[model samples]
Target chain A: MDFRKKLAIEPGSTVSLADINPEQDGGIESKEEGKEKLSGILDEITPLQEMLYAEKKHALLIVLQGIDAAGKDGVCWHVIRAMNPQGTYVASFKQPTEVEKAHDFLWRVHQRVPAMGQVAVFNRSHYEDVLVARVHNLVSKQVWSKRYHEINNFEEFLTENGVTIVKFFLYISKDEQLERFEKRLEDKDRQWKISASDYAERDRWDEYIEAYEAMLSHCSTAHAPWYVIPANRKWFRNLAAADIIHRAMLDMQIESPRPTVDIDEIYRRYHHAVREA
Target chain B: MDFRKKLAIEPGSTVSLADINPEQDGGIESKEEGKEKLSGILDEITPLQEMLYAEKKHALLIVLQGIDAAGKDGVCWHVIRAMNPQGTYVASFKQPTEVEKAHDFLWRVHQRVPAMGQVAVFNRSHYEDVLVARVHNLVSKQVWSKRYHEINNFEEFLTENGVTIVKFFLYISKDEQLERFEKRLEDKDRQWKISASDYAERDRWDEYIEAYEAMLSHCSTAHAPWYVIPANRKWFRNLAAADIIHRAMLDMQIESPRPTVDIDEIYRRYHHAVREA
Candidate 1:
């Protein structure tokens, strides 16, 4: 199945969280089968990512947005990890400090956009201003409402400059979130991830959903589209994200530039250096 | 005197290198007077630069392009040194490395553009693509010719995003360049800067002048204007550049953001912490 087509929120189309299944398996029978498919997708991503670095013709920016326990971190570890770390960077946006809040919302975001020949995965991004900032009333409606158009313009500018942007909105149900929270509580290694605000934020789930829906409806564009990935199932989430990324990279059709120097002259010089040694 | 108006290349207007005097000093009587004026300009810049960093509202990008031995580095050391080191960066563009050559000409340049609240000075910039590359026939006419429009669009985008761009073309005569080369040879401290290609490049001075004139005519826009400084007089060059930069930054009118937290509440909390201690 073409996961990109299956998951992408079409430009100018509104998305309803209730309509999409959080438990989607993409026709895979079981956990073992899903893991195998995910491995295959990761394998496909590795070589394409190398070509992306070698060709240096295009940059790829992957934006991940989700509520707590929706597997944003899991996707980064399992899916984006396929790319070489040398050319891959992950920028996680948490609460803004005084310095970040002083500038326009996109100020910090633009600084982290990928350079050519690289991939950048935004753990949370400029969308947070429209998401958390909107839901929490951190900024006035006048300010946050204007950002959708600003974001569209910014993304279009980046696209025109050879950055291919893919955004993922990880979808998970409240029950699944609770389950993950419970699992975190049981595991000592995951205990650090649990915060008192996690439970407090869960109470405002409906408001966050409304904000996410508005973001999807207004900001998705042909140049930088949003994807709603059913992320309750970890294996399926990894498989879907990797598959879409690999397809997007393949679409770039990056080719290494033709060598600009005279190969024969370099060969002769190398032999001379070897003789001197 | 409005040095910005006097020095700026008007958009869409062609320029002639021969018509402009590189020895013009804006009526400064001597090197000592010019140095005193430059010091005053630096004093004005220090406070404004501090406000820019505190406000975090805008970025400043200064591009310096010139022929070899034309005092680009001197301007960086003497003029730009007035700004605080914490908020200032200087990126010197040398010949492209193999990795850099694989990407578009602007890719390496865009990576070094200032972040919000910062100042970035490009010692020699993307103009090299059109100047050196065009003069030497490194790229075809079809390729180099299109870059003027590309550069304009790129600068316009940066300006719209709150980056103020100011480009300088340090103007010097052929005879002045030869004199500087002789001075460098006599000064042991400057001997490291002397290279054989500096003299060889002087032979193609006419071609380089044509390329620079074309660059000034085609790329200068209202948002990112180019200034041709009279660099034959080194002290005058420093004074002119500093004066222009101070004016441009003053125009930004950057104000520190309002305190986000309540001072009274912070004061109470501070007292409570002191009592507990």
Candidate 2:
């Protein structure tokens, strides 16, 4: 499947995120059109969102991975904004807490997986041990390498047990990231978002890219294929994400379980209450 | 203000929620219509969201309070899901951790307040010390009573420094809650959501309502009016929340800041880059 073209994967297959410029060719798209398309798709998918909630036997898992300013949060906000609130949950994984560190890598994650008829989103997920931890030498190479198989097994388990997984990696060039960083620095309100860690991470961009490549090569199974989105243009990132979610939900075609009570009878009684009141 | 007459405010009164009987009043509104209205509002407010991000000077604090099964989390997912990610945040307050218990009442809260030009939502806020804690007798009445002034002062501090507080209390009848609880029990997927704590809390419904009323009377100020939402119907709950958020943002009249570079110049640079490529 030409993932690079469909997902807008970066041109320099080996380049670091800190080195790519926003001005780089093939790294961005028309913003207005992208946003318009995403909104249209979100509208079309509203019914499917309700259907998934009613069919509460299958769960969905969405994974987001991106560079510092690659619009992962924006993707989440736009793509799933119309979903049934009761049937959706989002969990953001951060640096391992003391509690998390004590357990197996997947322990905390397993607890947060969406139950039947729900959608669970992972902002940054279990892959961190192999990505960030590897880039920073936080864990030994042997240990990190072994985790790829563990992650694959875990995802396979989730699929077998009724969870559907959709994974995305936001790809933006180094130059574009630098420009966004500079913009954040210039805006006083956004200054707090800048951290020493971001700068340090930028310094190791190449290492992260290498780790990401290894992850994609090892874990991009048919059940959970990785989509590398070009994220220099925030609008395009959101559109691609919405489109992917819409397609996935439509494919599921979940039906509302048969109600024990006739819906028409329920409606008649409801109207009767309004009449009496 | 006739809260019951509020267009989006579900059944409209605390009295209504208290009287719900599922077998009798299977009240159903077009859920799709509420979803559409919320979507329309989001589209209308996109420019405002963009403007707020550019202005980045005003901070928003939304406070949610409700009876059990009153839909606070549902409200959060809809309203918060529509916001711009860069300038939005959420904090959910639960039973205090050991670290939290040692601090001043508002200490944990003070740490989570949003920065200028951002939105921060508190799910069950500092008022909990006065509401739930007081009702359960977890704290002395003397301590709880003093908290009203402290809360007023804390909010005033935030407002004077550019934060706008928006508080909502989800009101539902004892019967409606029982219906929801029953639904949870009957549905295997939702059974996990039911807990002994929920039942224990339900047993003191009247006491909690008294506490809520007292807290509302004392702390609902001109700066932050408590919006009592009838939440027996999910559609009404989502719409009521959207209306409040829309009104608050409108009151601020947030405008987008002028672009740093003219659009023509940006497009020209883009076109030039495209030609070179």
DockQ: which candidate is best? 2
Grade the docking of candidate 2: incorrect
Q: Tens-digit lDDT track for model 2 on A1-277?
A: 2223365333324433344343322332466655667678888777676667666778889998887987777776777666744456567788989999999899999988887877877888998888989988888988898998899899999988988888888888877777776666556445545655676688887888888887776777766767766677777677667777777777776775654443333324432322111
- Global fold similarity of model 2 (TM-score): 0.59
Tens-digit lDDT string for candidate 2 (B1-277): 2222352223212332334321221133467866777687766555566567567778788888897788887777666767755356557788999999999989999998877767778888898999889987888888888998898889888888888888888777787887786665556445545556676788888888888877776777777667666677776776667777777778887755544543333334432332121
Candidate 2's displacement at residue A258, Å, is 2.3
Residue B261's C-alpha lDDT in candidate 2?
45
Q: What root-mean-square deviation over C-alphas does model 1 reach?
A: 17.1
Name the fnat for model 2: 0.07
Off by over 4 Å in 2: A1-5, A8-30, A84-86, A264-277, B1-78, B84-226, B229-277
Residue A247 error, candidate 2, Å: 1.4
Give the chain B TM-score for each candidate.
0.95, 0.83
Kindly list the per-residue Cα lDDT of model 1 for residues A1-277, writing each as its tens digit: 8999999998998888999999998988999988988898888887777668766789999999999989887787678766655466677787988999999888999998998988988888999999989988999999999999999999999999999999999999999988787665544344445556776688899999999999999998999999999998999898889888988998998764543443334324422322111
Alpha carbon lDDT of residue A52, candidate 1?
Answer: 81
